[model samples]
Target: MSASNAQQYAETQIQQALVDGLLAEGFFDKVETEWFSAQEAESLIGQLPEYHQLVSDSAQRLWRWHYDAKAGLALVMLLRPGVTQAWEKVPGSRVLQQRQQGQALAWEALTPQRLIRAVYQGMNALTDTLDADELTAGQQVFLDALAVSEWQTASSVDHRVDTQRLLERSPAEFFAIMEQWASLLDRPYHPTAKAKEGMDEQEYRAYMAEFAQPVGLRWVAIPRERMLCGAGVAEGDQGPVAWVADEGLRQRLDAQLRERGLADSHVAIPVHPWQHQHALPKWLAEDFEAGHCVTLEVSDERWLPTSSLRSMAPVDGSAHYLKLPMAIYSLGASRYLPAVKMLNGDLSARLLHQARAKDTRLVEGLHLCDEGKWWAYMPPEATLFDEAPRHLSAMVRSYPQALLDDPSYRLIPMAALGTPLPEGGHHFFDDWLAQRGEAITAQTVSTLFGELCECFFDINLRMFRLGMLAEVHGQNAVLVWKDGRCDGLLLRDHDSLRIAVSRLEQHGMQDPCYRIKKGHSNTLYHDDLEALLFWMQTLAIQVNLSAIIDTLAGHYEIDAASLWQVMAQAIDTQIEAIPFEDEDRAMLREKLLNAPGWPYKLLIAPIIERAGGPGSMPFGKGETTNPFRQAGCAASHDRKIDTEENVAKESEALERKSLEREAQESVA
Candidate 1:
């Protein structure tokens, strides 16, 4: 069919569906038939009395029914698609018979009666506390029953409900009501209370350690429950170190400190001379008795030791820990060191090992602070001497300089070669040349360019392979400039780590494949592709022909453009290469022309322009059909002549022929 005919058919189908839906819901009887047309529909909807409210109600009902039907269909299809057909073949009314069977099952389970009781209970609670204006009687009852049923389902510890369904309710109402109900039932609940305060050094340490013992709490780095204020032990330092567990909770305390911001002022912890042995641990008894922990006597009339109290004012600064509930327990800064080390260590180690194998020395041991900060410690010459390297200071200061001077530091470094030259030192390309000098011949440059291209391709391919994406840019890559040569490169930062498909599968976690198997995954909801695009864009790479080819061919050991043709052939000859289900295969075919692996679609423009025959326009007509057009296109185009000229010319001719046929038809 023609495009116009197809559009008309779709419109007619949609109109019929809409009219049937409206009539079924009793809206058709309320509105005139004249209101069906686009202009008339808008005018009639606007002029009707209480139109906005009526429309809103109608839309809500429609959406609710649609959602219910789809959910029912999905469940039914999962159990047996032929159930609908079997029902149709029954002697009685099909819809009514199905409804009766469903109702009967529901009755056997006492679902309706439970729902009614829940609705009544919720209505009673609502009447006592909520304002009448908040909801009408009917709406209130409906919402209350929904809330109760949903809460019951979600509150079940064994059978987990859909998170999306749980999220449908307002967080404020859900949390408040759930907490209140849980409290009334004396049930264990997740706390949303503020953190506690005024914890002594020993108390704070014990609390932090205890808080971190739980499985879920292992990953948290900062204390969760207590607004702790006191001096405690630093990992290496001997003297009592002042610290705050709850950074945000002690805002008032922080404000006071800022107000009394004396440059050299020191705050002392309150210590009781007549120390209670019971309060002190066995190892700490001697220090406690000697007044090393505090300065005041416990028995002194003027000195009231507020050790048992939850909150207290600081001796000099306004620092204090406020009392909060048990649920607020959070991990301190020290807890996340291991995770930081694991991630950064793995990355740095990989890069360092690769560099070392190639006789490169760009990175050294990666260090993670107790505060979860990462630092790559590059040794001067792989051995520490009596004197520290000058570059140590430069490396320490480089982070600050990179952040401030080069916003693209994180992205550009990983994807490209050469460091950001110091202002006016040399142009990037020139600096790259100057360092390599005579060694950087045309052949070397070409090889380096190819390597850089392959690096990007591999990185992206690894992203897909791992089912993760890295927000790689220049800054994330560190180029070790020794004797004017790039000895090594490093990729850093964990915030950029994303889950790729293979990794998800390896973890035994549910992936997009689950949706595909269940018939829920389709082209319209291609979240995987969307995620890939997000990765590309975030990495500052355009989703153009070259970028697409590079990304798709990243894992292969070949040029991106050449890899595309190979992939196309593999699609035909090697089904395993596609690695998709039947539905995915159908979906992929629909999008084949625009898909990343199709070289015909990717090289059309460059090929056409290179022909320079009849109907060939000048190179810079601003109408180049290639999606990879950019300010650097002319340069890139010229660079490609040596490698890609023949392929590009052929593709361009084919595109021109197709365009001519389309033009001829339009004229006819």
Candidate 2:
């Protein structure tokens, strides 16, 4: 046959093969029958350019039969091929024979469900041969059809009974198993309950009265096995109080029951009731130790506490009322008590006092509680300057200067935040870095780095004198600016605070002072330095010795070279100031010399060259030294800058000469 005629014949056979395969395997039911038409087959054939030359008349005719068999059936036929002539052109025919042998065993073992899975998998694989959109639609239709059958099957008694059994075992386990089952059938399961637990009748009534004010008695409803049961909060006429049940709690209860070998016995499972049985008064009496509790009283005369500032909403479209006895707690305190109440009365007194002192109507009203707590309420007209920590943290990154200038500004103990220093500082740095990436200029980053280093130097000096250790990190140091100039710095989050035994004894303050005898302790200095390095890296700043010196010089209004001299002198004068041993100092020196982009790369070039010698270095000979080697160079550069001012002068002269020559040539 002529090549053109053979090619034409091959195309016809390939098209026929596709149609035959679809028909043989009943793929028309999986995808639509219309999808396997001549037009679609031509389009698919055009996509397979690699096989064009090889698809001859005889190959096309044989392939037509193969394609007609459907994916699963065609695959089987390709593997077994009853006739020897069918196997003649196929490459790696032995591999197909082996696969066929294994597939035969699998085919025998497959149940109806397994067969369905295989059919779905086979249909999906053929999607590439059809229009992508059409293939997707067809798959969806097939899945929808299968879903109807699955639903019908699930509705049967056996399936329903099995599902109930699974659910009853453990709510969490049951839901997990159901999720797996649904995934197989391409379905989703949505559970409504949030929690599963119930208090006794008395406790329920008491809780309702305490929490739900004004309303006295309320009825509660608990759902079990799709049925809602009335759990009366109080004996009288009350509406139902409902709460979502937690599935996890239910699962735990179920597990506990089984573990205790009491599966057969009735368990007192906790259930959330729908409503409270008693009025607010009765609930308060039982729940609150004090007979009187805080309440929101909004007339034009009432004051709003800062603690309840976030929660208040306007009423009557005119006035807002905040709940009394407003609570506030430090972030660190949250671990001990996740929630805390701020007594409205104490806060109110403080507000009133401040208002009187300022001679302003800042605080509208005040209320005091028996527990020595006060709530001070402010109207909508109240100024934000009254709040300290919240306002400071919120506006610091953007309008840091304003926060610093506020009259209420106070450096509270870092322990007030309730969380440890290092982690909090790290998170703070991350948040700041994310925000600063878009907003900060290179100049600003450089300035911030320098200022931070100076702050650390000052803080370290203070710590040395006091014989105390402080956890210092980017997060710990809050930079406050006013009028485009850094005005204030605050360090906090003091859970990592450490004081030497001698200092603690000398201070002799009983209420706040704590002592630490040094012995393998994770003290503030050790942790803080690590945190400082972390912040430096996160900000993508090089933390080499020169960088540190540059920062200090900028902060103190001295030349970089002069700053290094000063630092060296300071170090010498305060030999006893630092806790690090001589060996540690040497190691630190080596690290500084080798740090990347250390600005004194040429200084370490000789050492690196010496290490390289005649033959090529095992690890890249040129610029890319091991990181440790780089760090050593950086450390050495820093030490040289500190101890030898003349070296810096010489380096500066070379740099100036190079710049001057470049400028003169450019002019010419």
Candidate 3:
């Protein structure tokens, strides 16, 4: 791609994020948009190349909104409007602003940085609490994201490796490559999705999963009495050593401990290299001065980062993947490892196991990573929710050994499937098409995607029936493919499990006593089933599958409506097959298929609202037009029309046959 193309693409993503967010968060309602018909904007459409294709139809409209009342207006074309409005190509890509006092407005191309600043200034007018510092910080983040995204897009063109070679290698290698591709596309539809705030360009290339660079662990020694160790963290630093298979590295780490003359009393905790260099010194200065924390220089073990940057897999192939704390902001939340979160993961895992045992479908279709082995530093006075303690913690997420060892089974993160290669094809779907002996047509791809939807929704709905829901978004949910079929789901990062206490009791299970910091809002337990299903509608369907649809439509030139129809059918099938109470089943049907809109997760507004406060994750909710309803209702209406036409044709044929018989009898 040319530099101009790369920059334009990055700016487009930022523009889409801003308009979609503004719409969902109801900013437009505060200051409504002014629209023009295609005929009215004929001259404007002829002048701009971007608007040429969008205004071909008479129904298309051009939208103008005065984000800044003093001088300017943002311009975009409206494609489709529902719960979430879909605009043509790049909304806000071009702005018509006044250049001089009482002068005619001229169109000016807007960069991502300027777009964010204009929107921020516009929003600041409506509210008194909007901070200048926060706006500056947000602008910097947007610029960082734009640069990183441009580099990623340029790199993706030549980054293709042989898919067969990856699959033929060890599971570790195959997963690493898949994750690298997945990392290329971050969370869908977010403004600053690619921003790694703390790292510079060099650190980003070195540390991000897309680069596939081997990362070395930094070991920190904390006295045993001061550390809070989980179940599998063995005594005398053996747990940390066990992650390293090499004997030489193990010996070096042990020697480093002994050389400090505190080997017997201290336990080792692996720290991210970036954290060790920047955050550790600042967060643990007192501990180092008091000799409570020791930083060792013996770094030998090498690992590869997965899509989730904090999680790392051993370079030498193992079931174990390490999760550590890195003090950086991504998606408006600090990526730190807190013990309270880990403990909740343990609790959620137990609940998952119990729910699986009760339902045979879950037993067949759901898999979980072993998040049992974890350790954190807890001083005598600090609580589980303390910020400082979270900076020094680790969790070992291990796959089932049997699943990993089996040659027929493959683990691919759903993000990999959702993110298409920049060179115009998807690696996973191409392989699937070849394996199935089918041609790459829209029908074939839709068929395969339908199967995936069936398996994915089956497991998710089963958990929903049992009053539990996993964060089945692309990153957390891994599709388990066995012998060319999407067989089951493998879930990791089990920290934020949503559940309904009443539903659990109906299935003969009790609540797993979860710990929450005092006075903090509790989002884990929901009183009503709709609250739990909100997660299903947003994360699983909207965020995860919608991204896949976008990629597939763009790559295969298939209509997105067709894919949404397939998904709606799959969801309908599952809701009926799963035996729910009559009332519950009706509710599911109404909310999922018949409802006018589904709950939309507001990503950007919530982050902006936070200004700069610490939290688990930033989220706000709004409603979006139900994609399922849009497709399903259209499909159903089409089928109805077809049936009526067939009946009319049959009646005409019968009438003609009767008339012919009557004429023959009269001649006789």
| Index of the highest-TM-score prediction | 3
lDDT tens string, model 3, 585-604?
99999888887778888876
Of the candidates numbered 1 and 2, which has the greater TM-score value? 1
* Candidate number with the higher TM-score (2 or 3): 3
lDDT of all predictions: 0.26, 0.26, 0.74
Q: Tell me the spans in candidate 3 whose CA falls farther than 4 Å from its real position.
A: 1-4, 69-78, 82-105, 125-166, 233-237, 632-668
RMSD of 2: 28.0
lDDT of 2 by residue, 197-231 (tens): 12233332222211111211111111121111111
Task: Tell me the TM-score of each prediction against the true structure.
Answer: 0.25, 0.24, 0.89
Candidate number of the best lDDT = 3
lDDT of 1 by residue, 443-545 (tens): 3333444444443443344333334444444333333223333333334443234444444454343333211223322221224643444444323332222
Q: Could you tell me the lDDT of residue 634 within candidate 2?
A: 32
Q: Looking at candidate 3, what is the lDDT of residue 257?
A: 87
10 residues in a row with least lDDT, candidate 3: 638-647
Worst 10 residues of 1 by lDDT: 75-84
Model 1 TM-score (2 dp): 0.25
